[model samples]
Target: MSLDSSQLSTAHSGKTDLVCYPTSHHILFWVNTVSYILPPIMTTNGNDRTTQWKTTIIVSTSLQNHDTSRMLLAQHHRIRFSDAVKSGSIVFPQSGIAFLIINPQELPENLEEAGLFDKIKKFVTVHRNSFLLLQAPFYGKKELDIMSVIQHRFLGSNLRVLPVRNNTEIVKGMLTIAKATSKPHVDSMRDRMSLARAHIIESSSVWEMLRDIKLG
Candidate 1:
């Protein structure tokens, strides 16, 4: 599902942020690069324990992509998405994540596909409580339209149709997705709400966000 690259446009600026890359908000966008994008999105777990976990997960369209994300996140510490979840190193989110950082674009022909897009859509719809952040390339118009359809059809809350138009938006989008992943990582009951709040984003943390996530 390689995008046509001519469909995305910046014409609509009524109230909502249509042109996200150039003039969306405070954050910057970067492409094909990762540094410190933003702190992982986290939730205060309802079932707080003695350890106080910080589950940093990297999600994408396919499990393979998720694997890709896992390798990328390993540079930070002794953390991997699969281990974080399997070993309970990274607990699941309080409200399950319907989906996050999904791209329909094909990775390779010989990957032994498992009906990727269909499966992703199914998971997102079934798990209604989980947050779904749909990542889409902002090349031009065609990709944007496809993204719009996916967002509208999905039965999830606030299906965020992210615009990875330029490096700034891509970086900012990664920051947002990583932060969302943190809810499962630092799964603590107390201060979960407070932690989720983006009040104190540090400089170093911001750079981490850049490196952890990717853009198409």
Candidate 2:
């Protein structure tokens, strides 16, 4: 059974086929990303360089050729899809790779012709150390179905995939966390400053401004 992008998720359901990538990192962090700009990385595989969650891959195929977006990921070298597969097999990296955004529902015909099933089997040969960031639709139970496919394909006994879908639920979740962590009383200037600082930290950095500041 093949998994689609939406099938990608971190939810657990009675020993799910797809395992969410594990870690103790930020939603987005510095990675050895290729392509280097907006939505730079296409995929990532990891073993132990992560403790919680690491955003290592991005499905910016549209931005694959977009160098500005590619460079932002920190690493300079750009690994391609073809390089990912060697001798008709996928190999995991020693250190965990990050941020792999995949729309697995659709795969390259060349890859399929080369035997996708066989290749994935070899790739997941028990703790192969690869991580995938698959895409998904909306959010919820739909993730379970998406993850099921990825789980069955890989052969690694120790490989685990973490799933996250971009949706309204995520937004609501962040807001919920903020309220839970914050006190209702905003009675002082320091508290106000703290709130402002929290907002600044929580918000996504404006990349354009960051890119400019990085130049000097």
Candidate 3:
């Protein structure tokens, strides 16, 4: 779960069995580099019996950038980027770390938005081994507000959040979050109610407050 590139590099070489999962909106140069260095492998138990296990890296990006992403990752034949998720043209693998890169601008404004939220939720639900990594550079109240809504909803659903400001941090954060093989318990009623009350007191929004209550 460590983010250190050197550490991850070691793991990628099979020195240690530690696996890192990265689901990104865009495939960074480093990501493309790593995929080539580490082809996915099936680990076995002490008895030398292969398990239903694999480590992967998935990057999802927008249709507009789909071509560009593919070109960048072209040298790494193992890496694939597609715009098929929206059209239901894609089929996810059974087990492996995958990167889902999507166009950030195409993301829904909130969890209630049509198509976007449901599509993402369905993807994550089906890929129980998946962990979502949302990225944005928020420099204003409006942007932060949007992130707050996303954070509240996902956190309430027991998804871990890691706020990062740079590529290094993003890589580190994703690895740290993905190492856990279990889903966290859903937020308790008291915790949910407390969040709702805080939102109400802050006069955030009726919708946001109600969303918290519903999640509880």
Candidate 4:
């Protein structure tokens, strides 16, 4: 499917955060220009366990043939295509997060027109933890404008914006965020983070200096 750029506004914004929650309140780390937060590789039964798990994603039937869906399938994810979902959207029920993928070129010139905000409002209502995937070939003036509008409109809400350049980025970002924010995986990541923090404190000169001051 192709989008018309004329109706799109310009946009841009990305920041790194390191919150360690396993839900909507989680960290967003940047790597290879894609937003991802993979934990350190762990071993189980002498097998290296990365974040690749058999996760299920409920996708809109409208995107059943979309490239993003195909990419996710290629990665061995279980995808259930549903007509009941909002068009161009996918849901990771395990994480309680839903992603609406929209090409920047598809957005209306103004956020208020064509009930865009209302549609997004309903989306966020249904999926308490929602993310808007702004897909574009690259971040240009028009893309940045739309992103800015989306951010402003959803400010202070659970709706997060993930700007993706291609189907690969879209699938990668969604899976990264979804996996990081879901169940046992999240717990494991937290444990690893705690261990790392303790290691840092133990190895740091600042802590040693403080200890010396206390002893003196």
- Best by the TM-score measure: 4
**Tens digits of per-residue lDDT for model 1 on 16-53?**
12111222222232221321132222335544121223
Q: Provide the lDDT at 209 for model 1.
A: 68
**Candidate 3 on 75-109: residue-level lDDT in tens?**
24234445544332122242333333333344555
The residue pairs in collision within model 4 are 9-146, 10-142, 10-144, 10-145, 10-146, 11-143, 11-144, 11-145, 12-144
Error of 4 at 211 (Å): 9.2
lDDT by residue (95-208, candidate 4, tens digit) is 888999888787767768767778788899899988888888889999998889878988988888877778866766676667667888777665554444444445657668
lDDT of 2 by residue, 16-36 (tens): 221212222122211112111
The C-alpha lDDT values of all candidates are 0.35, 0.34, 0.38, 0.70
Which regions in candidate 3 have their CA more than 4 angstroms from the true location? 1-77, 82-95, 99-111, 156-158, 162-216
What does the lDDT come to for candidate 1? 0.35
**Per-model TM-score on C-alpha atoms:** 0.37, 0.32, 0.37, 0.71
Candidate 4's C-alpha runs over 4 A off are 1-51, 196-216
User: What is residue 107's positional error in candidate 3, in angstroms?
Assistant: 5.3
Q: What does the lDDT read for residue 96 in candidate 1?
A: 43
- Return the lDDT, model 1, position 212: 62
lDDT, residue 57, candidate 3 = 33
Model 1: which ten-residue window has the lowest total lDDT? Answer: 11-20
In model 1, where do residues sit more than 4 Å from their true spots? 1-54, 58-78, 81-98, 104-117, 129-137, 155-158, 165-216
